[model samples]
Target: MSDTSKPWNSPMPEPQFDLMRRILSAPSPVGLEGAMTYGVLKPHFESFAPAEWKLQQFMGHAGVVLDTHPGRDDLFKVMIIGHADKIRMQVRSIGDDGKIWINTDAFLPNVLIGHEVTLFSEDPGAQGSYRRIDGGTVEALGAIHFSDPAQRSGEKGIKKEQIYLDLQIHGENKKQQVENLGVRPGDSIIFNRPIRHGFSPDTFYGAYLDNGLGCFVTAEVARLIAEAGGTEQVRVLFTIASYEEIGRFGSRVMAGEMRPDAIIAVDVNHDYVAAPGIGDRRMQPLEMGKGFTMSVGAIASEQLNRIIETTARVQDIPMQRDIVGPDTGTDGMAGVLAAVDCVATSIGFPIRNMHTISETGYTKDVLAAIHAITHTVQALDALPDPHREFRDNHPRLDQAGALEHQGSEKPETADK
Candidate 1:
């Protein structure tokens, strides 16, 4: 609805989509999510705000805080945080011969079989890159053919434990050879994939599109605000949190460490209007090239929710909502229950086949998401401070100061 006038045959903007590919190309499976946040996203934060940006990481988790306003010092802030972690695996053990064994919470195990993967380094502090150790695959159905169908476990179909990492290196001592290359029993493992275009070519395909676009939009919103000369007026604490795919652990750590006046979480949802077969629209809507969505669920921050809704309407950003849930099942929940009890809300793009390799979405939705987030910050700047009302009434609430924002701070130093 925004601008699909450019025919489907038209090529996407080279520079912008290339950057999205570079971002989605980085591996941040599960526990190593913070690595991608710092190593991949921090550069964009710096490129967008340079002197005003800062970063933080803890136990493989990372946060990129953009200090748009170096002039003012206040706990009154808004954080656009998204979980940067994707469900990935760890090298559990290896077979004496050349076969390998792995363990992980692959949400969709069937989708992983026969796909490529990477064997990353053991150093928890190391950033994940494509060059680490490539050309690994999960065992296939016919390759490891079972005699009987009943032998499979009903609890977790296509058990990842039984699935082996087929490095396919020819030799008697394959384990020893892989180990010599720094692949260890405990090294982090992730799906090794390059970002490719979907069938229409207007949409992008890859793993972690679930929140990859969310992380993209969060930082892009800050960049957009800065571009519109709205940064100083709208100070957002942008964080690329980790472990969000499995749990809200990264954001939990972030909330404990810093306090913001309001939190607007940017994330993704599997709300394609055209699903394979479905009765409920709440599950997903039939949308592809339209704008993004907003949640009208229990956890929405009243002030922030109304502001986003109004902004989308006034700006005429094409979108749909009513994908209601109790707490958004996102880091937005962390913002709702944080120590400061700040106002929290979420706006996200809808993606199809969410956790699988073929996850697809339109750039139009992505740009709309970026616009919505930036507009949220800009709109919040115009409205009353949602957190200020609570502060006036409850002076005894535990107050947290912003970490050393500018420079020369211990943990405040950019972890990149």
Candidate 2:
């Protein structure tokens, strides 16, 4: 093996330790239930023209109450205010049995009565529940129903097909109560709770960490750049793409929209921590506690390689390079093809057992990525025109080729 101990072997210094410390301290773990909840609630929160009255009404009937805990009072308040501003409510009804019904007609259109649904609550105080409905889309004839918790335990883990919503309302005749409330079949059922966080002194986990980490890192970079009085010639689009896992939909749309001169896609690379298929040559050789990996391959741009290498040299940042054969299978591929003159690269962290409920990464890797990306942006701003340099440096390639051709003609005859 070649000596990997050059000056470049030194770990790059990252300044975002504090921010990453806080991030790792915060909880967000991804799972099937969380993903489903995100699909239901994401639209409500991300919509520009939010449905306010509808949301307030739903909260009113769902008996959504807000309470603050000691250390996280402000966090809870912000979350409440934010959720309230997004979801619109169509129906809020109370049942004789004291069950509550809250409906948002426009949020989900394909909902059917008796379809099993899982309910996630936004408030930490609310106990997340799962339920089933008796009738749906029948207009005044439908009743929201609840599943027995005992029965749920016996069944294999929550099945999406078997779940249904019990909009808590009871009537002697279900039709009469539904009619009074104006509930419809196609109305979306919002998962009640924000994805919760599980935190320890050493680990933080929650939903939406796939690209959420990217979002967090980019935002911090932007803040740092602004604070450092960097010039804003390069328009840095800190994109929080949606639907990436499904089909790279958000990145596809974003690449077209930005059409940037260059793109550096930051995504997680597999970390082989627990299991053993991954090897240093195949995936990232990066260790959990080591640092970030700067990949080189068909997807990486020559321009980007030059900048990153130069930056690493000047900054004394530790970086490792690996060959990504044909395609990186990252958003970088999309962005590179979209622009007239585009170069793409990826900075990755070692994430173990990706696409599972409990994907893991090191705090150190996250910090290293932040450092690498920030320096990369700075390097891009300072880089001289590479095309011009290439033309000047290699002016006589054609002449050299012809001379080599002439020399080759005399070499073939030699029996002597």
Candidate 3:
């Protein structure tokens, strides 16, 4: 029984929340994520990183790595990754009616209707320049009177091909009018809804909580580790990746390049406790305001998980166990995909309505993830020998010894 009447306030400090807001506000749609990574995260990283710390920039995408100790193979390396990209729509074609047909990438069509969006169009006249259009609204058949009976009753779902953006162009020569404004095919469109406080305390709901929250957690953890005088025995690579929404290509590339001994991928998880229509899947009841989640299955390293769990317990930080089977469905698989030969696990906070215009999260859970990861890194640094501990401490089946009978000591007759 929690207080429902309580007003919501941000759990993070003003500056931290401002940083998070900026990160979330910066559009980092799939193929074009540099705006967020290079524009926001790079500056944030540089502001607090020590003089000896190295900031590694990528040659292609906006993926970046902040290394506490560069070129130190002797030290145990740990890479903490969080992708910066958000799922977005791309311009497919322009209709003569002035409707911009779009390819809805990773979004359900029903969520796009009537919501305002920002179209980032590349300047045709200037090779690298771009223009931003902020007044467009995504639409389908427009009014309810135009919808078919099946569509009105929700029996038929909206298709991605049917989705288009309306920029309020009228009269004739609509296509020419759009082109004149530099709007063209292949432009990226993102939800213009900014993140803000929810009705509940310490809650927030808006666009792009999936991975922007992940990057925010990673960046905050990096700041914490830096302020703690840095690690002595471990070289930490704090990475903000790109293209995770597409296929985790950027994080896989980072893993291949760094080849760390272990990786902790921070990302968002579904708040299955509050998520609707997921009861048939029988997922664990993970929810917001429950601290952070740590991966328990999949390619998640058991030994590495032990370190994080122990850190959480020792630090008295609230945590939830997330069971991810076969694949983590996150950048946690970057090491495996790149054949990096490293232990890997995922850390996250549960957020409801993922991959939608109004994804929601709890700031307390985010702060918990930051603390958990920071302490885990410090715990690794304090270890006598990290490589040997992880290599030699794998769970053994023989360690359980023999099982004893719970009922009778001797065998009983078949029919007795």
Candidate 4:
């Protein structure tokens, strides 16, 4: 619980907050992120980016990268990437009764029912142009009275195929009206919910916080770095990627092209402390207000983690160590996937109810991440030779010291 009586003072400026809202609200379904990346974020990046910084646009996807020192391979290249795309439902088919069937992507069927959504329909008449259809609510069977005994009881679960959207259409020619409006298969559908402040101070909830928050953080960090006169020894690439929800496809392509020396993948993490029934499983205790999360295992680079953590400690920024192993499960794997041989790590704020229409986050944590990453870049720039630092900082087994032990040299035969 957080204090609500105190007057709300935003951690970020009003313009930045407005940008966050616009970026999160923009329709950016997987593989169709041009509305978000190109339309919303690109202009914002151009507004404050220094004159020397170069904006890199991709050919295949709507990914954008802001390079602090373009074509400077001598300096250490650090890419901070956040995907601009979000998971969403796609129109699969239309029923004669005006119901639109959907293939729910990465969403629980129960969380979607009764929630309003906006469908971006591709017009059959005009290819490459889209139209927005609003005021539709996802539904299943309409009423509880129509449900079977299992559905009423806890014994049954809602299936994804059973869900459909209702536009309140009537009359005999229902499907015709829908088709005439250009609502067809493959159109993107997203929650029409907008980002709004939560009951507690410094908290906000909305749809698509999973990676919108990530992109917002990346943009803010870049702005902060630019405001501080930019980095000296490091050529930072502030990158916004696409298709992260489907796979790390877009990031892999970006990494392959840029071939940065290091990458910091910014994304959202689960607030396991606030998650329901999470105590039943072994999970890290993380929450919205606990501050930003930094990865500790897997492909997380020790040198980069050291720089970030040391900066946090010196700057008194609250941070939580997240144990991500085998794979970071974010775009941190993009470097490895692309065979770029770059050191990588992930930074995020713990979010509650991820992949839902009501994903929640704390502003303080977001600001903390911004400050921490900004300072870490500054620290990297201050180093005389960052490439050598990362390459040589790995622990050497030869320098190991033995701990005092009270172990009798094994009577191995007797133990066996």
lDDT by residue for model 4 (1-416), tens: 13231112235556767888999988898988898888988898889998889999989999999999999989999999999999999899999999999999899998999999999987788898888999999997689999889988958979999989899999989999898898888888999988988898878899999799889999988888998899889999999999899889999999999999999999999899999986988788977887899998999988899899998877767789998878898999999999998999999999999999999999888888887888899999999899999888896779988989868886756432
Whole-model lDDT, model 2:
0.44
Error of 1 at 193 (Å): 1.8
- Distance from true location, Cα of 306 in model 3, Å: 0.4
Point out the worst 10-residue segment of candidate 1 by lDDT. 1-10
| Alpha-carbon deviation at 55 in model 4, angstroms | 0.6
Candidates 1 and 2 compared: the better one by TM-score is 1
**90-111 in candidate 2: lDDT tens per residue?**
2354344433354533233223
Question: What does the lDDT read for residue 284 in candidate 1?
Answer: 49
Q: Give the poorly placed runs of model 1, Cα more than 4 Å off.
A: 1-12, 50-60, 70-75, 123-131, 140-157, 169-171, 277-286, 384-416
Q: List the candidates' TM-scores in order.
A: 0.81, 0.50, 0.94, 0.93
Error of 1 at 301 (Å): 1.6
**Clash pairs detected, candidate 1:** 272-285, 273-285, 273-286, 273-287, 274-286
Predict model 3's lDDT versus the native.
Answer: 0.89
Measured by lDDT, the strongest candidate is 3
Worst 10 residues of 3 by lDDT: 1-10
lDDT of each: 0.69, 0.44, 0.89, 0.89
Segments in model 2 whose C-alpha atoms lie over 4 Å from true places: 1-204, 276-284, 336-340, 386-416
Query: Where is model 4 more than 4 Å wrong at Cα?
Result: 1-10, 403-416
User: Candidate 3, clashing residue pairs?
Assistant: none
